[model samples]
Target: MLTARFKLDPEDRVVSFHLEGHAGDAVKGENIICAAASAIAQTAIGSLQDIARIEPDYQAEDGLICCRVSYDGDDQDQLIQIASLMGSVRIGCMQLEDSYGSHYITCIDES
Candidate 1:
C-alpha cells in the first residue's frame, strides 16, 4: 500500500508531507492508484513553488515523495496560500485512501 503522512503544527497547519511505498493494485506500469497519488502530490508541490512562490524543501524518487514547508511567521499571505494548497493535497490523499483502501493509506500527525 502507499502510505501518506501529513505533519501538522500546533495550530493545525501542515508543516510537511511524506509519501512512501507502492500501490500494488496492478502490475508496475498499470497501477492507476499510484498514478493518481503521484498526480496529486506533484501538483501540490508544483502549486506551492509556481503559484505560492514558496520553494519548499522536497525530494522525490521511486515510490517516495517528501515535502517540507517552513513558514516565515511574518508572511501571513504566503502562509495562507501554503495552507490552502496543502489542504487540497490532504483532501485528495484522503479521498484516494477512501476509494482504494487496499492500495492507499493516509495519516495526519499534529504536533
Candidate 2:
C-alpha cells in the first residue's frame, strides 16, 4: 500500500505534496491523473518547489496502477478545479481519501 501526504492551507490556495513509493514509471491510464495532480499542485503553489518528492511502488494488479499522492495548498476549490476536468481527463481511477484534515489522492486502477 502506497501513501502520500498533502499539506495545504484552505484559505490561501497553496499546495505542497509528497509521494511515497516509486512513482517514476507511467502506467497506461494513470498518466492524465498523475499529470493533473502534479499540475494542480504546481498551479496551487505557483511553483514546483512545494512538491517535496515522489516515490513509486510495484504491485501485482492487472490493468491497474495504484499510488498515493500528497499535496498541500489553499482549499478543495483548487483541487476541484482540476477534478472538474475529470470528464475530459483520459486516465485511470483517481480516488481521494480524507483524513485528519488532510487529503490523499490515490490511483486505484488503470486501463
Candidate number of the best TM-score: 1
- lDDT of candidate 2 over 14-64, digit per residue (tens): 132343432333564364434544544334332222332222222223232
TM-score of each model, paired residue for residue: 0.90, 0.28
| Candidate of highest lDDT | 1
Q: CA shift at 98, candidate 1, in angstroms?
A: 1.2
Model 1: residue 22 alpha-carbon error in angstroms: 0.7
What is the per-residue lDDT of model 1 for residues 2-103, given as tens digits with 9 covering 90 to 100? Answer: 888888887788888898878887886578877887888899999999988988899999989889998777888888999988877778888888887843
Could you report the Cα RMSD, in angstroms, for every candidate shown? 1.5, 12.4
Model 1 score (lDDT):
0.82
Local distance difference test scores for all models? 0.82, 0.33
Query: Candidate 2: TM-score?
Result: 0.28
